[model samples]
Target chain A: MNLKRTTLIPLDDDSLAESIFKSFIEKEMMLLMVIIGDTDTIREAIPKADNLAQLSYFKMERWVLWVRNYEILSETLKKHLKASDADKSKEDYNNIKCLCFSPILDKVDGIILKNAELSYASLQQSFFKAQAHDALAVNI
Target chain B: MYYLKRISTLVLVCFTIGIQAQIISVIENDKDQKRTISLTDKQIVDINSSLEIQLSKLQLLDAIQQQFPQLKQHLELESKLIKLQQALRNQSAVISILEKQLATASEQATFFEIMNGFLTDIQNDPLLNERYNDLMAKFFSTDTFAPGTVPEPYIFSNLNNDMLQIEQELASLEADIYAVSVLAFKKDSSGGDRVHIQNYDTYTNRDYVTIKRWVTSLSTEQKQQLEALNDIAKQNNLKKTNVFNELKIKLLEEFKSITCIKDFKNNSIEFINNIQLNDVVPTEVKNKIEQLNLLITRFETLFLLLKTDMDQWQITLLLDIKSEVETIVTLLKTIDTNFSDVTTLINQTRVKTKFMPLVSEFNTCYATINKDFETLKQGAALLFNLQNNYIANKAIGTEVLAFTLDNLPDKGYINLKGTGQRKNGDELLIELVLRLPSAVENAPEQVVTIEQREFIMQLTGPRSEVAIGLIFANPINKEDLNLQNDRNFFYTPSAALLLKFGSNKSHFYNDFLDFGIGLNFATPDFNTDGTPEFGTGIITTAFKNIISAGVNYNLTLDSFYWFFGVNLPFNLPGIPINNIKN
Candidate 1:
């Protein structure tokens, strides 16, 4: 049995900063962005993530995100995915779409994603869609 | 053409009766060509962890003498914290009661004594004596009860008695079948490999060898230039610390993937094809990039320091230089990453026509920049290793180990020997130990003796590599391998090597059915009287959920007892419930 492929994710709820960098060294998880629940928290998180993205060791090909762990929150995930199929007039309709685009990454990036998968094309599309607007708020 | 590998390994056999030569080399030499080696994620993590540990070792709070202890303490406490948390959860409610009892006793002693007593009580708990037994299954064990849990069994049993006895735990014992979950030990990257030699377990720390003993070509002029580079790096321009990345990010904004598909294809072909190998593109920002090519020339001179034993001042001076070079290289990589992504976008089968010429143009420029980046990384790592003082004679060392991620193997073992301890009692030489599964975690650090011991080496990985360890048999720790317990029901010999029949595609966890017979020095037997019917106790292992149901017979008793690999949990007052260690 080849163990190099075996991935172990020890659930952590401690310091998100240490957890992110420590797990970055682990490389078992591929985190593109860190989705945050609180907008006020982005000030601290974005720089930490920026430091990670810029770290010489990480050598990130693309930028990481500071989104929500909507995928793990299954009910929130279903609401967002189903909202995309419904009317587009809802207050948070677009934010829900971006959050649902790849929600599993919220818990552990690169988990056996069943809801949706992340790739360069998909990420670029979602990124530009948000980049055109206020950058933080997903356009409804 | 996907990934060009230039693999070169230099082997200096550390221990043996005779000196042997072993080397692996690969090269399709094109000067200044890009060489990329793909590594598995696990391998990358291991290397990163190893480097992190190496860095931590250099950051001592007090002095060099105290550094080892602090680093060792930090690592041990972190790993032990996981198990300590589990034990704490197991004894949550009782902790406050125990604390109050200790608090009442503290009225007689000093605060320090009370604290010591409190710690002693927790350590002495028999149930929490996790180190002594297979409480490991509980330590890092999954908390999920989805497997083999016989739920809602509180009803229907022994209804005829004055008080009906519903023993659900015992009811499962009637079945001869056993179910056991498979678990593999995680790799401990803190430091040292704890290997068992004989009756006692001896651990050895990381060993270092010097690189390149040949005469160095570092001229007086080259040293002066490198010093200038180092000085530039040492300047703490707080505002401009991130100038290189900032400039690169701004430059990338201009080169962002052209949105219009027509412009993307046409502009890429035109812009890429227009790029000359030796010419620089027009830039509007000052990012310390103008002298990027010249910097590579300075870093390449580090390769000449093969024979030069650097003084502490020079080593410290060069670290800053290393930092500057890496900063420049990283900026270059950002460019490469963008270039590669744009090229990857167009290299699809649908656009094969523009692909070849576009790639042909891109590779020409990419090769030059890629080679310089690779060289800078190699130079930086070599300088870092020198700072760590892991040096040896260059005559025997053919290749310097690269600290960079690009060139490392997906899986391999590095043998670091513990050079004998220090003469001064106050000194702490780093102790390297290749830990086995059953190696005592809390064993007190002791002065390791120097001796070349014979070993029966076994290599096991979930993949083709079997193991990187020696074979030994101690009844106390029967089989101390990740999958060793899976082959639990066996005669553990004084020395035994695992035998496998090509099941290459299977994961390390998923067990396939197989049977083998091994000779045992001490055989086991179980008696109905709650004593081992034989001298030694029998152990059973559930392989791939295939219940190993066997009967052991003691010739003296002339009685048969059914044994299952999964020991059943029972409530008999005097008998050992799950374990029957002889």
Candidate 2:
């Protein structure tokens, strides 16, 4: 399925980055992919994400990021997320379980999550399911 | 002796008869003559008694003549004695006849002497001489008297009546002369001989010493008689002069009185005219002028009988006075005209002085009010323009949305476009499109339709430009947004620095619409229970660079809940900040 959504955010750089980071965390993904311009803050955040997954960085005009399994990120990494590119294509995502966070995502096939659809129960359900699957796989 | 007595008695009888007959003829022939002799009763008896004595004596002589007729022989010696007695008788008769002639001659001489004295007295006085000649001409012109003939005693019979008439006229004439002399011949109080007659009428209790002297000099009577005569002549000359001086003083008074009246009348006329021509004449002065005029009019009539007697000086004076009166009348008329003109001019000046300042003040007030009215008119017109732009722009937003919805496309991408121009040089090109989902139940399988709307607004003329602004979340409500009670609400307070490119229109600092920004703060209290809302959003207007309206949008639980309402830049009520600009 192809899905698209748009959101208006505050003009402040910190608030913009927070909005992008929050969307990324809600998706519960592992393998992280990033597209960023040549900036020092993004270069530093790339090494920190190695504990969750192998980091791939591409130099571009706008910021774009992808995560595979549920992993919590540090606040410093979230503050730099506003540089993410929002208008990306479907061919950019390699796996079916990938979660993308951007200002705008066009011609991408996925389930759209907005403020209306993200309730407290849905977030808790996603967190527990991810935890249960991880414990089961590790024991086996 | 008896014969002698008888002859003498006869002779006396014949002589008496002859005398009686002559006397009777004289009395009978001149019956028309006015006799001066009026006999009394006692004189008639005395003459009759004397005639009786003569008749008795003649009877005695007759008896003696008869007894002596036989005694002729002794008559020689006796004739001598008788002759002596006859002589004595004849002498007695002659003596009686002479006595009668002597009485007649004595009466004639006494009458002539009295008349001659009266004429001499009149001729000797200057005042009387002039009038005596006039009177002689008047009286003798009617009587047939020879030149130098003494008037007969018969003419004197009417002397008292003539003198009475003359005295009355003289009295009138003297009174008139006294009045004139009172004005013209004033006696100096200082006892100087040089007389000053100016303003003589004002002198009181004056003694006319010069007139008295002139009167006394005209007569040679005793001092007492002269004084009495002067006093009588001055006091009641009209009554007493004819009796005392036998019409001599009366004629003198008449002549002088007539001459003086003529002279004083001319002087009075001149005096009155002078008074009338004075620049300022009091009531008393005017009264005096009228009195003098009356005196002249009366005296002119009174002196008419003396017209032939008027001297050259009197005629000249009258002519001069008439001319002077005419000149005074003309001068009075000129003065009256000038007075009327002066009164009118003063009134006009008074009115102008009283009202001029008030008129000037009124004009000034009118000018000030007119200027204020013009300013008010311009302000009203500016406000009207702002109001019209606001209504038109708001209507365009709502009507365009409704029109686009009415022609919605069916489940496909459809585009609508419109273009218009605003009065304040703003141009608009609106493009709208509808995108509908293929199926709502497909759940994440189909892409959600996106609605696209674009408005291209630009300035189309000079003094026209668009203002750019920024919108932001309000700091007061930034932390209050939560899902429990503020699920679909947000608020922002914004500030914008407006830039107008290619236009010279200035901006107001407090006007949010000019900057295209406003403050919008709202909370859950503003919305209905269970109803989701987008809260209030206030936008500054760019129409003529003024702050205009605000919009509140609300999205309900099941649909979009919103409405359009007007807003002010400040938290004040009513038609926003446009009123302040005006």
Candidate 3:
């Protein structure tokens, strides 16, 4: 099943944002996210993400956002849906999710999710892998 | 006392006689002694010669005394004859001088008389007066003649020459009039005029050519007037033709150049400008061109505005397409039908907040384009209407000009026919219309019709081909017809035959005044009673023809029936026929 979701991340936590992006890529999930912060931090984060994957990135100082491993994301969605269904998938997702980022929670608005099962599976798998690795290290 | 005076007188006389005799004897004795004493042989011869000379002198004296009375009478007669001859020579010389003066005075008077006639004609005609004034202004300081402001010698010479030519022409005209008068007199004396009066039945007809030849002789001024009128008419025709032709050519050229809407607008503007620039163009045509230009300008402005609106709308459409493509690409990449990723994309790009305004702008642009299109359509239609009107008016003007030129009056009658349905059941029509030229230029044109004073006879029957009627209309009005005052207005009136044809019963009147015959055919109808019944009526109308009065009679037959009526025709004095001959 095709999975699409929008979630907010804190502005100061670069590691978490990077971790979230890497985890989504490993799971072959499409991750489009907005970073609400100062221009210097967003600008620094854009290059790090560019080195990791070929993606669409917009540098709006007021609202900075980036996409990573977009080709893999398209392949994953195509594999799950029929050709006709895939044609309208982008428009449907745009209709559901907000395309702006804000620093304040009140200004954040709501996160939108499409095909939530894949998003939940990708997140759960990532946590389990981390836990497994930790148990192995402790046993050694 | 008488006897004594006689006796003394007798005594005085005797004493005086005796003394005279004695003195005579002494004087004779002294003369004989003197003569004898002076005598010699030679002296005696000389004395004898002297005595003989003296005797001859006395004889000559006696003869002179006898012839003196006859000689004196002859001398007196000779002196009187010489005086009378001198007086005769003086009188002859005076007569010759007076005759020359009279001839010169007569010539000057004739010239002035002819000039006066010309001035009178000019005064009567506004156009001619204007031309005359213009011509006079060229030669004189003022149009009015003033004493001591004599024209240049050459001007006078030219005028004199022209006057002389006119004098000769007038003399020729007078001679012709005299010739015709002589002919008329001869005809009268030869019993031709009497024959017409005494034996009217035998006088078949007056030869129109001969009569016309006699009557149509024009005076010099009249000939000149006709020539001037013809010249004016020709010039007017030329002006009208030139103006219309130029307009037609210009319009055609403009139409040819107008391909696109822009070209149409530009070319139309140029055409209008060209027309405006032309001084020779008629005012109505100029006004029409101006109207056309206004319409074209409006059309161009509206069309350009519409195009600009469409351009904006198209740009907005392209932008919307780009946005749509971006949205589709995002969806393909993210597989997010719920649009959560798209919302996030929009949030990251900061484009989401601007979408509603963009959509509103697109809507506004589309609406503007539509409104502009509507305005352009209306403007285009208005422009088309102006063009059509201009073309139609041009056609009408061209036709009128052509007709005026082609149908300039010749020596013949023009017939015009018109028909109309009356509000009341009858048909008002001109069946056989006759229009005669006023016989001279500057006279009002008039038409002869049945509405004029006339006599009519009709034969009507249901079985007849048509309800046939005969009409003899009186002469046209003197003012309108321009008939000569000297002409006898009384003549056999012109005749026409009216035949009603077809179901609506249209009347077709054919003139037979020139002895031309015509026939019309129509299907016969039966009366409602199944019998062949005929119905007839008479009505009079005025202003349909030249002013006048009339009477009518009709005979209708079932087998045979008669109907009759009288109609009076009159004209309102000031009103004229709407369409008169040119």
Best by lDDT: 2
**2 or 3, which is superior by TM-score?**
3
Positional deviation of residue B394's Cα in model 3 after best superposition, in angstroms: 8.4
Instruction: Report lDDT (Cα) of residue B543, candidate 1.
Output: 39
Error (Å) of candidate 3 at residue B424 is: 17
Q: What's the lDDT for residue B168 in model 2?
A: 52
Residue A80 accuracy (lDDT) in model 2: 31
Q: Which candidate number would show the highest DockQ if scored against the true structure?
A: 1
Candidate 2 at B42: error in angstroms?
17
The chain A TM-scores for the candidates, taken one by one, are 0.26, 0.23, 0.21
Interface RMSD of the predictions, in order shown? 25.3, 98.9, 65.2
- Cα lDDT of all candidates, in order? 0.29, 0.30, 0.29
DockQ of candidate 1 against the true complex? 0.01
Residues A1-140 of candidate 1 have per-residue lDDT tens digits of 11111122222432454454344434432333334333443343333333322211111122454433433333433443454432231433224322212221222221112222232222222322222222122111
For all the candidates, what are their Cα RMSDs to the real structure? Answer: 37.4, 83.8, 69.5
Expressed as tens digits, the lDDT of each residue in B1-582 for candidate 2 is 999999999999987754432210001111133222111111111000001111111222222234444323322223232322322223333233323423333332332233334444444334434444444333334364343332223223233344455445444432211000111111123221111212211222223221110111224554676587568646763443224233223322333323443444465455446546654545454564465446445434534422332222131133332333334334334433543343344234423343344334434433443343344334334433433333332222111221111112111110111111012222212122121223344221221111111111222112222222222222233233323434333222222222333221222322222343343323323333544234444544554333333443322222222222222334555422222221
DockQ of candidate 2 compared with the true complex = 0.00
